[model samples]
Target chain A: MKAIVHVQLKPGVLDPQGQAIAGALASLGYDEVTGARQGKVIELELSGTDHALARERVEAMCGQLLANMVIEQFSVEILD
Target chain B: MRVAVIVFPGSNCDRDVAEAIAQVTGKPPIMVWHRETTFFDVDLVILPGGFAYGDYLRPGAMAARSSVMRHVLDHAKAGGLVLGICNGFQVLTEIGLLPGALLPNAGMKFICKPVKLKVTRTSTPFTGSFTKGQYLDIPVAHHDGNYFAQKDELSRLEDNEQVVFRYENNPNGSINDIAGLSNVSGNVLGMMPHPERAMVHGKTRGDGYKLFNTLMETIR
Candidate 1:
């Protein structure tokens, strides 16, 4: 089984990296890009065959360590 | 009082803090490496400033999960005094020992300078010697020092007097101008300022020296 986690800064949280990226894009003549919020995607390989259990484990991982719950939100996707 | 300073792989301020503590307490603290799982018997545990784990993942994030932090958490739970400064403060938030998250500076730049801070209420294990509302100039050097928390938590910290220090001029855009915080039990404290870096021998006033004095006095 495999799992993927996407972690992003929560809405209303200021993202300096995203803002800087957006600025760079503007300087590079990509004026149409209004903003860009950077996030992380983590792919995990697990031995579990159960889809539900794998999803649960990944979500738990986000809550426990992968994501800073106070400032970021995370989503989990399971791949079989 | 017995003090222990935790040293993570990238911690650069461990000796500075240990020396500051020693100057005040008249004895050097024990240095515990990141791999240590036990804090041994100590009255206080300090997490000093530095780029722990090279600030990877997040400032203090990896260090917060190290074997040493597990022991630090246990110490705090047992009502031991835990002080985290600068990057150490970031680790405290990451470890969930302190509330809120420290984001990038609003201007998105690394700021290093002395800033004025008003002692909020004092009378805690960290600020027992300072007068309430006293203005202390402390040096802060970090990239991500902006403190943020939900509305309710911010107010709760205020209502409970857990806010130990507030910036006199809001240097990093931290919410509510919060510069330092203490756990509800008043045993754990995390702040962005580098109090240890400001200590100087004898002439009696550089700004950070007073903090170490107070910490040692409180411990005594």
Candidate 2:
């Protein structure tokens, strides 16, 4: 099974890269771009047949290595 | 003082920090790799400033998850002295060892220059050498040094007097001009300035050296 995790800064936490990207987009004539928040995407391949087990492993991974629970929030998805 | 400097793959300031500690404390610091699981009986552990893991994904974000950090966190929890500079500070915050995230400069520019910082509250393990309101000129080189925290958390920090240093000039738009902070226990210190780089006589007038000296005096 394959799993994907997207980690992002908590809503109130500042996102400098996202802000910089938003500014660059505006400068390049892309007005109407309201905001941008940068985040990380991780793809993992697991040797599990059960989706629940895969998700549990993914959650453990996030707690251990995949995401920093302090300032980041992560969501995982199982893929075929 | 027996010290250990944690060296991540992309850490560029480890040697400098080690040298500064050696110069002031008369003992060279051990260079520990990021993969190490133990600290090996050290009194002070420094997470020196640098582009750890090339500052990939986020500043100090990747490095915070390194294996060594687990040991570092454990050490801090056990009342060990931990000092995190610039990139080190980012890592500390990323790992939740310290409060506040270092946001980009309000101007969205990489700021590299000497800035004046005032010793706000020195009742901690890190700033006992300086008097309250004393100013030290230290060099800050970072794109993201602006510190942010929730309002209640900020109030809690203020109530506990965990704020150790504040910028004299407010160069980075940090809340309340905060430049450095300590953990609630005061054993963990995370600051954005490069005190090790400012240890030389001519480089920064040695104000930064006082910080190390102060720590040594307390620990010894």
Candidate 3:
């Protein structure tokens, strides 16, 4: 089993890197690009066979280490 | 004062901080590796600046969960003084010992320069020697030093007088120009400035000497 976590800054948080990306896209003549928000993806490999147990463990990981709840939120997806 | 400077694998300022402590207190601090769980006979614990864990995952994230941090948290709970500088400050926030997160600079550039700051709170042991509103010239070198917190929490920090330092020029777009802060209990302080770099009188202004000097005297 594999679990993928998407971590992103919360809505109100300022993301300078994302803004920079948008600026770069505009400079490259991609005028239609309105904005960008940067985040990170973390994939984990699990040995467990149970999907439910894997989801629970991944959620635990997100809360403990994968995401900083103070400024970022995370979503976990399981792949079999 | 019996000080202990915690050295994570990538911590580069541990020796400078230890040297500053020795210069101020006349005793060199014990250099404890990140794996060490015990900090016996230590009154002040310092988390020096550097890219711990190569800033992996996030600045200070991996180091915040190290086996030794559990003991550091215990020490903080027991009213021991903990000073976090630059990357150290990031670790404190990551561990939830201090409120707020340090985001990358608003300009998205690694900033390294000396900036003017004003001592906002002088009641804590960390600032006991300075007059309220005293100005300082401290150097800051970090890529992720912009501080962020929710509006309500920011207000609470201000109301409680936990904000100890404010940048005169708002170097990194930190909310309210916050350069340093103490926890509500006033025992743990996390700041982005590198005071150790400004501790020598002839080579530098030695503006940071008062901070370390006052900390020792007040704690002693």
Candidate 4:
């Protein structure tokens, strides 16, 4: 099984990379951009057979290493 | 004071921190690697500034999970004094040792310059050397040094007096202009400025000696 974790800074947290990207886009003549926030995505391959167990493990990984709970929120999805 | 400076794989400021500690405390600090399990006998643990793990994925994210950080977390939990400077500050936040995250600079450039920091609180060991509201010049060098936290968390930090230092000119667009903060117990301190770099009398543009001096006095 494969699990994908999407981690992002919580609301109100500054996203410098996203802001930079937004600026770059604006410079390229793409206006109407209200805001941008950057985040990370991690994909992990697991040997587990059960999908539920895989999800539990991925969530644990997020809490332990994948995401910083203080400022980041993560969601895990299982892929076959 | 016996100090332990944790050296990550990509850390560039370990020697600087050790030199500063030696200059202020008259004792060279133990240099511990990121993979080490034992922290040695030390009163203070410092996560020095640098591009740890080349700032891969996120600043200080990879280094935070290294073996040495487990010991750091344990030490901090046991009420040991831990100081994180610049990249070190990012690592602390990455490891959940401190609240908030350091994002990229608002201008999207790697900033390397000296800025004035106002000491908002003097109760912690980190800022015991400075008077409240006094400003000190410190150098900062990082691509990601803009600190961010939720509004409620910011309020809580203010209410608990955990907000230690504020940038006088708000260089990086950090929330509330916060430059440094202390943990609830006041044992863990994380700041974006490089106090270690400012420790020398001639090199530093400001009175950098006070940071180490005050911390040493408080710990002693």
Best by TM-score: 3
As for candidate 2, its interface RMSD to one decimal place is 2.9
> Chain B of candidate 2 versus the native chain B: what TM-score?
0.96
- Separately for all candidates shown, the number of backbone clashes (residues 3 or more apart, or on different chains) is 0, 0, 0, 0
For residues B107-197, what per-residue lDDT tens digits would candidate 3 score against the true structure?
9989999998899998888998898889998899999999999988889889999999999999899999999999988899999999898
lDDT of candidates 1 onward, in order: 0.88, 0.88, 0.93, 0.86
lDDT tens per residue, model 4, B114-136: 88999998888888777999988
Model 4 accuracy (lDDT, Cα): 0.86
* Clash pairs for candidate 4: none
lDDT of 3: 0.93
- Candidate 3 interface CA RMSD, Å: 0.6
Task: Write model 2 residue lDDT over B1-220, tens digit each, in one string.
Answer: 8899999999988999998998898889999999988557888899999899998877888998888988888889889999999999999998888987787787778889999999988888788878999988889998889988878888988998888889988887898899999998899999999998788667444887889998999999
Question: Higher-lDDT candidate among 1 and 4?
Answer: 1
lDDT of 1 at B145: 95
In model 2, the Cα lDDT at residue A14 comes to 72
Please report how far candidate 3 places residue B43 from its true position, in Å: 0.8
**Residue-level lDDT tens digits of model 4 in A1-80:** 88889999888666667888888889988898877888878989889689998898789888887787767899888999
What TM-score would you report for chain A in candidate 3? Answer: 0.96
Better of 2 and 3 by TM-score: 3
Better of 1 and 2 by DockQ: 1
